[model samples]
Target: MSSDPFEIFLVATPGLEAPLAAEAAGLGFEPEIQPGGLTVHGHWPDIWRANLMLRGATRVLVRIGAFRAMHLAQLDKRARKFPWDQFLRPDVAVRVEATSRKSRVYHAGAITQRFERAISEELGAPIAADAPITIKIRIEDDLCTISLDTTGESLHKRGHKQAVAKAPMRETMAAMFLREMGFDGSQPVLDPMCGSGTFVIEAAEMAAGLVAGRARGFAFEQLAGFDVAALTPLRGAEPVTRPATQFFGSDRDAGAVRMSGENAMRAGVADWVRFETRSVADLQRPEGPAGIVIINPPYGARVGNKGPLYGLHAAMGQVLRDRFAGWRVGIVTSEGGLAKATGLPFQPAGPIVAHGGLKVRLWQTGPLGG
Candidate 1:
């Protein structure tokens, strides 16, 4: 609120800090990678831009201020004195969440209550459990770092993907995985087991130069000093030219195909993306230059029995190898053995990423030979 550059944290999916940082850097931000996220120093517009443009960040947090509080009494005293009106609005409700590590104030609930009460009484702001604005308090080694969640829902919600399939991949993870697979949005991308068309739709959006948050509203819009007109330029008025290279997705389930098409339409990428109900064995290379084929297939952990999944993976690998020449492949699965069953010449697997209570990795390959 002071118009000074502050710390902006781009929360990354675990094990994917590098790709997220790369994305941040590509977006003209000087990103410093941390264990689970990256930090960039910037002003309010920078925070707004990050919330709008960053596809890999799960959420963006702006560090408002910090103070050293040894105990609850000191925390309460400082909380009452802290200037909450600068960032938070009295008309908007807020939620306070706190975490304590190796600190005297070890009770997180008490810390949250103290801060909530302080804001409610001092700033005349209402506190609610389901508030759109979130104040994050991290008390580590007795140093309390106060940050605000500028992203209301996780960025993955993207707001347009209303129809979802079983064990669907998050859009944030999908974007980073596409980055990991070296997708630059200029070439064709196909997902044989495209659940809800996440990869295909994301690729199409990237290719069409669509802002990731264009269709969604952010929590930062509710902040005290937010200038709505200032964000208009970031939300460009330039019309999107359809990409020449098409994005494709296929699923054996007709319902999934319909869902994919509906999601793509909602995302405004239907003109550039195609979805169909087809099994992996029936997959044929579309008439075009080869590109990337990526799939988040069942890993037996969630979808179904593991025994038949091996055959499914093998069949998928066979179809790609036999038909989709010159295309690179990336298969995401929880079990290494399932990835191995693909029989594609995969390079060493990428980092183990946390997805839906299971650990998964991307098994990638160079362009397949004839």
Candidate 2:
């Protein structure tokens, strides 16, 4: 924990690096995307803020140390020597994950075993693979680096949604979708194909001035000398009142509608949003002036069928065009053919962002006008 802004890494869905870096910069962090993730130069406070505010990031990592190790022994020795007292706690459980390339520690399992033993024996820390605290290791050629996952569960979990549909929305992707649409809290936001209500929940949270990290406990809290006290003000800050009808979500599936409503209640944003069950074709335009309409419909892979999705896209596009005049529209899909099937003119706006190994892009129309 040197005084200098520690090197932090933000792992995301590949093509999302640019947007994630832009998000980091917006949060006052200096971020640069490297190969696997974005590297940010900042202090612990900056790291905390990134974990709290970065909606597009999968994980926030603080680079504890990096070194060149020619062999397994060197890796173990360096691993043990890494001032574990600063990050590891004797009472807490931790997990070790490793990846390798041309390095001598070529076996990920072997690397995890050795590193796990080093921490347990040298630092007197316990090891638990399923634990909240995780130590991530990456070995590219001869370079080995170690980082700590400050955000235990993925930021997408948001501590809500005990139930979801077949293809629910990921919080990171949902946030990115909203960002692409330039969604600010000022106007009404809608998600007609709301699924489990992820987009509406995220929109409401943003509108209500809620910090994404406030509702959940982070893995970093269990680490040694974790300044939970320093975070008191953040946790105690007055929760934003649910804005009146600023956010709306609907799904055709009645079960999904019930689950979304429950999830919103758990997230304490029920008042900020309205949830209903309706087919995408029947989606009505918002009563207020033009606003943003975002949708993450089933991409065929998750729903086990794509035959009806084409019709869904067409109907959604028609609704956006005929009913929601003067509003912006955004849709996320991994299939370009289906996107084009919408029949509404749209331009692709993304690099191939990786999601579960499938590359997805956002399709957007210019201004929603006749």
Candidate 3:
């Protein structure tokens, strides 16, 4: 509501900050890369746009203000005087969360309770366990920073893909990986192990010029002075230009293939994407120009065995090498040995990203030799 610029933080998965920052920059924002995210200074509409368009961010948080509070009494006093009316509505239920590091206010629970009391008693807002609006408080070295989560649900939800395969990749991470592999939606993307069709669907959406958050709502809608009429133009559909090449996905399991197709359909990309049941050994390059081939193959952590995974990776490498000439390859796996077993001339492995409680890296290669 205020005309002043708010510090907008785009939360990224650990180890993937650079690409997310690049994404923000490409979208015409000057983003400063932080430890786990990127920060940009912008007005309220910028916060809304980030939540709606950024494919790599997990959530968008707007920094309201900060204060130095040495004790709980100071924290409580300052929180009571803080102008919560600018951002929050008294009619809306809110949730308060807190984290502390190297600060006197060590107990996060007590910090949460204090803020909850301040907002409820002073600002006349109700605190609820299942509130869609979240106020995040972080205390570090005696400095307390208040932020609001503008994104109600994680951006990866994307309001589609009701069906999922085992160990499915999040859509946010998939989009970042696609960007990391130099995909601009100009060429085809084929995922031989496309569980739930994340990569293919994301590529199709990007090619179709679809907004990532178009299908969902955000926490900012619940904020005070949120002009829905002013925000409606940002949500307008862009001209959809179908890509010249089709995005493709395949899996050995018939059920997985079926699920991927259904997910693609829900994503509104079924027309530009294709899903089929086929094994890696049976993979054949599509009859078109060379493109990117990315796969999140089964790793030791996912399948509980490293022995068989090596052969699987090797077979994948063999098929790609023998059939898909002039195509780049990207393989996401937690084990370096498994990536090496592929025998592809992989460039340096990408950042170690945290996925499903396991650390994984992207092993990529230049165009395969004929």
Q: Which candidate's TM-score is highest?
A: 1
Per-residue lDDT over 63-84 for candidate 3, one digit per residue giving the tens place of the 0 to 100 score: 9999999999999999999999
lDDT of 1 by residue, 184-286 (tens): 8888999989989999999999888889999889999999989999998887534366688999999999999999999999888888888989888889898
Model 2 misplaced regions, further than 4 Å? 240-245
Off by over 4 Å in 3: 237-239
Best by lDDT: 1
Ordered by TM-score, highest first, the candidates read 1, 3, 2
Q: Which wins on lDDT, candidate 2 or candidate 3? A: 3
Stretches > 4 Å off in candidate 1: 237-240
Q: Poorest 10 consecutive residues of model 1 by lDDT?
A: 233-242
lDDT of 2: 0.80
Q: Better model by lDDT, 1 or 3?
A: 1
- Check candidate 1 and list the clashing pairs: none
lDDT of 3 at 62: 90
